[model samples]
Target chain A: MVDKKQALLLEDFDIEIVSRDLNFYYGDNQALFGISVGMPAKQVTALIGPSGCGKSTFLRTLNRMNDIIPGARVEGQVLISGKDIYQHGTDVVKLRRKVGMVFQKSNPFPKSIFENVAYGPRIHGTRDRQQLAAIVEKSLVRAGLWEEVKDRLNDNALGLSGGQQQRLCIARALAVDPQILLMDEPASALDPKSTARVEDLIGELRELYTIVIVTHNMQQAARVSDFTAFFYEGALVEFNATKLIFTNPKEKQTEDYITGRFG
Target chain B: MSGSFSENLIYGLLRAITYAIVLLVGYILFDIVIKGLPVLNWEFVSGYPHQSGASGGILPAIAGTFYLVLGTISVALPLGVGSAIYLSEYAFQGKFTTIIRMAIITLAGVPSIVYGLFGLGLFVLFFRFGASILSGSLTLACMVLPTIIVASEEALRAVPKGYREASLALGATKWETIRTNVLPYSLSGMITGSILGVGRAAGETAPILLTVAAFFLPKLPNSIFDQVMALPYHLYILATQHPDAEKVRPMQYGTALVLLLLVLGLSLGAIFIRAHYRKKYKW
Candidate 1:
């Protein structure tokens, strides 16, 4: 069953992450039910659904972020670069380094802006002062926050505006140089202008990295993603090109959700 | 109009009660200051007590109290903070953890005199350390351990979960995330909590009386094992045990005043440090 799904998903593009029949539970309450999907490399994939529909859970399982939650349990395989992440002896720290994440809310550490960006590289063993400085600059530039924050890199990160802080969080994630980025509603808390800026940033980032984003806004999914997966009630109702999912969804539930009929 | 009148009456009653409590505390402080000031010269502060503390300064008692506080801090802060980190960050929430939490809360309410007796049994008699500064400090540390642990755990929990998640998502290990993100932010709170413990340890007399206090040792301790004079015990002796307690009334008030000042100074210093760190880490 997994092999057939893999063949179908691998038909058009190179796959960076694939979860086969993934089931997740928190204690006795199941949150995800046999989810299978593939995210293409160097492309943006958006998971859209209503609140508590397990889009965020699926995103977190890619990097095992849910491991920190008490009683959270996952079954089936999450493959990153064709390696099953749940297998025995897999190093979670190394897995997370390869697949970084951005949370729904901006959560920069209470440190200097420079320190916030430098944190990832420092933890991964980049030690020289000059090397750290260069990494910090490159990450900030890539996140498109360097121009605004270059003069105040030493200021406390909490002092930044909300939108700027979100960008700084992106830069911090980028510093580790992950190949895949998992974002859980990265712009849901932002103003319209900031949201547009983040959407544009996402468009630019897809050229260099595989991005999987979970969002509730269908318009955001349509604007920023190449592929869209519509999740409802912990099940994937449809997965296809973003244009098809929006205009000609195969599943009735997908059409209903996309057309604002009912969640 | 009736509702407004009732509200105003309640508000006035509450304000009056608050002012009454304040006035009571102010009267006690005023009485102490008025009696303590005339005898609080350099001679009284720095000179050795003579004739069973009937006349002279309380330098030895001051030094002993300072040493006791230092020892309590050195012993309690690390143990308490470490336990707090384990409880808040690492420990799995289970029956075991719940029991541990219950034990800590119960320990916090246990009487200090009970701790004094425990110290007498464990450190003084069983360990055979005798009535010395080492025994007294160990006792005080045990007594304040619960307070520091409870406060430090509260501080650790007060930090937003987002910081830990952000650090972990950035590929940092659990300990590394805690070291960089959690501890630095919660440090001011932990220090503030520890200073409260230190204040309690410094002012406590019963624990030291059973474990280390010397009634008339008019000199500083030379070693941890040596008996030392403490402000509370000295004041207790001057107020009640001294043969000429009537003549030493001013000395008693002076010793009480000095001890109060020391505890207040320690708390104020900690408040300043906490404020500085709070400014640095606003989130």
Candidate 2:
């Protein structure tokens, strides 16, 4: 074990969310061990792992979504823009305002397309109807869903096709306008075309928001992300530039994952 | 081969018997409808109790029934739904909470007459409220409380967790997520539950007797605190206790049919709202 302090960087970059020695547990079972990852400002960092490897658990720890689960516990430091999200004075609600998420399933709120997109902005106290409309429009446009559902803004979101619904969810997350966006396989439930569109949208969003994505598809990570982190059964195996991790990896586990071995 | 054929025949006979029992309730409904139709005229609905306690309309009793049912609903719905929200969304499920929930479900299964007796002991006796509409409504509300709570909890639980996730992910608090998304999304189901609850309460005869029984010798209630003639209590009395009841038996059947129609209407209304929203939600 080398005291390679240089393995982790914390000097100059704007850290949107910095997790150090983060661990999680569900009752007696441990989901994640001590994991450290630096999520920089306005970049897409993908967390890729196989089934039951704790990628989702790690993503959930960021905003304390796991707190909603009974007997779920965590020990660690997860800082969103400098303040630790788990600290006593930290308002989880306010913290969530600074960090948004999109889930794997396209869960539009069974409301209208317009209302679904506008839900977040409303919660944040944006009462100006016209501005809300603009935010909705801009968000839908950003998620690449505006062109399809623009005419049917009042139509229930549940009525939309699978692809359209996922984009609507993205639009909803963007409507909150958080500094960081967490997407757990946002495109996995989508078709290939929709996946490509979401990938493109992720690339576009990277210019403005810090994004942490969890995906099984390695090609997706290579295509749209700046950084990629690999996890295997609750440990961070590697974290590096997308190109470096995929083309010239360090650890044998990372190599195995990239080479399509048992994840 | 002979034994297998007999076994099949016996199984078929059992199925037919079970189905016949299920369909038997329809025959009773037909009996009520056939006997009640002629006497269910506007004059009978609009009139008051006549001389010798025969031939008059049950307008005041009918009116009192609506007033009581509505008041009970108004009393029970909010508290029931509020409790359900707290239990389902806020309460951490554990052994103690499970015990509490078990007690509640058990409370629901307790007989209506026992609820009436309990109401008599509580609302009427302990509270010293007397046999007024307020007391009756309160008793009826207790009778229906479990129904509303179970229905409401089921409805709340049926709301997809993703909706809450979407709301919370966007920075809304748990209460806000419930208020904005889960509540509205489950409104249709909740209403269906409420309708069923209302129907149960409206049709319930046993508890109302001990808590709010009326001899109906005549008059209308002026307030919640006033003693009013509830239709079920009125029907029960006219059917069983009326001294010259055979002469007015047709009116009792008519009242029964009307009660049936009212419940059917409420159930249909619930189904309508549910289907309307479901259609709107369906892709």
Candidate 3:
């Protein structure tokens, strides 16, 4: 693990999101302990850990997605673009619009391909058929799905292949024009080829949006992320450059986890 | 070999039970069709009853039942579906909600005659709607409200949670999420459930007996406040109450057959709606 001093130096970069002594609880059970990290702007930050290690919980806290669960509570500050998102009177809908999320399962609405991409913009009050169609096309193009589904805009989204469906979900998230993207195991449900396609899309997306992804696959983290944070038992074990974390991790636990030892 | 033999034996018994049920239902339907077909002329269906329902057709009864069904649906669908949405989506799940759910299940189990008495006391007497179609429909709506609410809640629950999460994550408000992602997907299910409740309301006799059923009125209702002749009570009177009960046996069978067809038609409509939506949204 990088020492506290070195981790603090990461703030020198143009940070997009930062958590300060963040603690989270589901009812009485603590799920995350004092995690503070800065994610650089326009880069991919991968959160890698075994199942039930609270990496997904931490990702959800940034966008307040966990608020929907009864008795889920959060402490400390989650700052996005230098604004404290967890402050009182914060517009959570606006916060989520700025920080879009793609779940592990591709949950395309029971709508056509065009409608799926158009849903976000329409909800945000993008009327006018031409403008809505334009936004849909742009989002699908950005998600790398336009070429495959352009002709079949009116087809049901659920009829797409697994990989295409996942890409369609990415397009749906992109349609709202969010600055940050949070993906929870976006490719875990896809086959190897589809996973590669999604990984490539993520690499391209990192050029524009700040991305925080939770993954169980170490190889995926190394391949797609610029920075990697390894979480263990609800605590941040290590957060460093992806190369350092994969090739020469400073912490023994992270090194053990990366080398195929006990997670 | 022993496992395979036991499996085959169990399957055989299950199949036998299934066929037995089919045969029992088939026999009852056959009996009704054979006895009623002779009496089901166009005049019997379209002409008003005359001679104390022993000679003329039962048009007024058919019209009354149709009106009762329409009124019951108008009153019950919105209230039951609204209650279901509130319970499943908006209400906080706790002891209070648990009690409410328990009360609904208990109400569903209440006997038809008890509902009849309740309607008599409440809508007919207390509300002063009189023994009219208005009172009968309101009573039938109350009786089927529990069924619609339960079925609608189940349908809403059947929508995948991920859809809500996805919509919310994209900055959609909770109501917006439900309106767009949840309601459209679950609408088929809600309609199916409501139609089942409406079918029950259309066929119920006890609740309407005390509230609106007219003994031998040949004239069609002028308004909801006018008392009307319904099929079930008409059949009941013809079979047991009329002086020439044996003579009106054919009329009783015909009335029973028409009621069966009406309910069957409503169920078939529900199935078609469900199938159409299922094709549109397979997930």
- What are the fnat scores of the candidates, in the order listed? 0.77, 0.77, 0.88
| Candidate 1: regions farther than 4 A off | A1-10, B1-5
Candidate 3 chain B, which ten residues in sequence have the lowest lDDT sum? Answer: B196-205
- Model 1 CAPRI rating: high
DockQ of 1: 0.82
Q: Compared with the true structure, what per-residue lDDT tens digits does model 1 show for residues B1-283?
A: 9999999999999999999999999999999999999999999889999888888899999999999999899999999999999999999999999999999999988888998999999999999999998999999999999999999999999999999999999999999999999999899999999998889789998889899999999888899999999999998998889998898899999999999999999999899989999998998
TM-score of chain A for each candidate?
A: 0.96, 0.94, 0.96
| Candidate 3 chain A worst ten-residue window by lDDT | A1-10
| Best-performing candidate as measured by lDDT | 3
DockQ scores of all models, one per candidate: 0.82, 0.70, 0.81
Ranking, TM-score, top scorer first = 1, 3, 2
Q: lDDT, candidate 2, residue A120? A: 92
RMSD of 2: 2.5
Q: For model 1, state the Cα shift of residue A213 in Å.
A: 0.5
lDDT tens per residue, model 2, B216-239: 736777777777777787788778
